[model samples]
Target: MDSIINSRNRCIFGCSLSRLLSSLDGVIQNELARREPSLYQWYSSNQNPLVVRTFVNTFENDRRFNSATAICSEGKPMDTSESDLSLLVLGLFCLAAITKLGSAKVSCQQFFSMVPDIIGRFMDMLLEFVPISKAYTLTKDIGLQREFLCNFGPRAAVPKFANDHGLEISFWIDLVQKQLLRALDREKIWSRLTTSETIEVLEKDLAIFGFFIALGRSTQVYLSSKSHTDSNDSINSIVRCDRCEF
Candidate 1:
């Protein structure tokens, strides 16, 4: 039947992914054993093997679309969203690696370097679209940072080698805040943005925000399900004014 054929294809696809992860994990384990014997033991014995199960359980879960929209540069528009999503994914894997591997800058420097840039740039792009001025300013204050991190950040460089090259999180945060104010006050960029422009930008901002929101919630649930405890508020809410237009 048609359904059976589709199911078989899905199974094959999942199996391929599992095999790939298994192969990569094996390589990782071998390297860890040589470089970090103690870590290798924990990875092999304590942690469960990374086996992927099914991918599409529902019709909605099916990923059949060939192409999708991507946010491009406002000045130089591109057909696709480009490298941002890839960078974001790599960044997240690093964070997960840190959580699982029990190491900070030394162990997860790649993640630390990359995640900040992604957050900084994405947040910067997102604030431009906020429908409310007050909400936009507050979010920009906290979210946009890491001007240098986007440039001088160690690209795939090991922590052992490139530990000194990356920017401190606090430093980038301070730098971004200062930059935001200057661009707002001195540069006078607000006149360029109108209420209509803000509304137009809202969908893109919400798309990126919603994706992270979902990821955050799912991560929280996964962590909490492992151990019950009160959750810290990772995301702060800024209520948009219904009366005001950006």
Candidate 2:
């Protein structure tokens, strides 16, 4: 009876989520159709809508992300691991958006403007996971450049937008490489990390790194299943690092 109850609960939760996503997607489509018909058309006809759909499905009515963004805006210490992890995922979504939609046939200026500040904060937050070394400045001033389509001739924005995304991808690649190495060396340093202060920091790092590893593998499998052949090599390596850590 207990097992049956649990199964029923899981089914109920799944149905609830499906309904929520359908409702939200409908609302978004209606708004886009009214405000930006071109965008709506493109989005509706997009051959691979999985990425954007996944983004919407994951973020719908998610208050945890809302609270995390508010806290980050205030420069408050986001001490909770959930907030930190949420911010990281948010940053990833932002990157993915730039890569996937930057060169699309419609105006994304309004969308881009709203996210620059958040992306800036996310860049700063990402640096916290990385060690301050001569290789990387503790506070690198990397901003998400918004050269939207309206600012210049049509399609002119793609270069700068791609450059900004390149900066983010480079930073992520470096961080992932370092984390992969650190994760491998963790066993050797287990005894040395016995101190509470060191252990706490290490635990946090491990948690964040583990999130990246899991996300990477999922991304790899997703791209593979989709037959994405022309993906960037660095991004491919980032996703392929699943084997390295596991």
Candidate 3:
């Protein structure tokens, strides 16, 4: 009886996810029809080469870049092993979206503006199953989480936004990383860590390195063209360190 109930529940959950994807597809289709009539016509007729490439790129980034990091963050300090399953569902959804609707034919400015909304929706759906506390733990990695929050958090007109959100996010990430590093060092768990465990740690560290690279790139693109020359030089210096080679 318990097994039957569990199977039924799983079926219901799958149906619900299917419906949600359909709804999102409809929304995107309607939005595109209203916003880009020419592109919508091209997509409807199945005649555009760039449409397929753009769709693939968007889906790939959503899956590889955003979804992977989100999954990793979902797995931190909580019983979130099951949350990893969301990546599969999200990938399927992206595949379906690309197959049906293709990418939005919009300006970069419009696309950038739309991205946060899309990300927020994705995060909301993920949080529905995973819970915020667990996700927060995963996202609070010292290097990436702080930079992410600084870029995205809400702004209050009275007080500065970066100070408010950035500081809190930074503190949490720092606290978690310090605790982890201290535990690892004190326990001398490196000796005990299996090859897989060591690899996981190395991957997390690489994620941090990737976050720094992204930050430098964003700074170079938006701030000063020369900004990344110094940043790359700094990264090269650090990467040359004996301990950093993993």
* Candidate No. with top TM-score: 3
Judged by lDDT relative to the true structure, which candidate is superior, 1 or 2? 2
- Candidate 3 local distance difference test against the native: 0.44
Using TM-score as the measure, name the better of candidate 1 and candidate 2: 2
User: What tens-digit string does per-residue lDDT give for candidate 2 at 1-246?
Assistant: 544543443344335334434654675687788987787777767833867677665665576466445543567554554454455545545444554555343244444444444444444444344422311331222122232112222322123335454564355455656566676576444343454367777886566656656877776775466454326776566666654443
lDDT digits (tens) for residues 20-122 of candidate 3: 4556556556778898867667665674557767865675576444543353453553223343334534533443343334244332333334433443343
Which of the numbered candidates is closest to the native, going by highest lDDT?
Answer: 2
Error of 1 at 77 (Å): 29
**Which residue pairs collide, candidate 3?**
73-138
Kindly list the per-residue Cα lDDT of model 1 for residues 132-234, writing each as its tens digit.
2332343334332233244333421222322433333223323434443454455333343333267657555455445444644554454355442333222
Q: Which ten residues in a row have the lowest lDDT in candidate 1?
A: 235-244
Could you give the candidate ranking by lDDT, starting with the highest?
A: 2, 3, 1
lDDT score, candidate 3, position 160: 34
Give the RMSD in angstroms, all C-alphas superposed, for model 2.
22.6
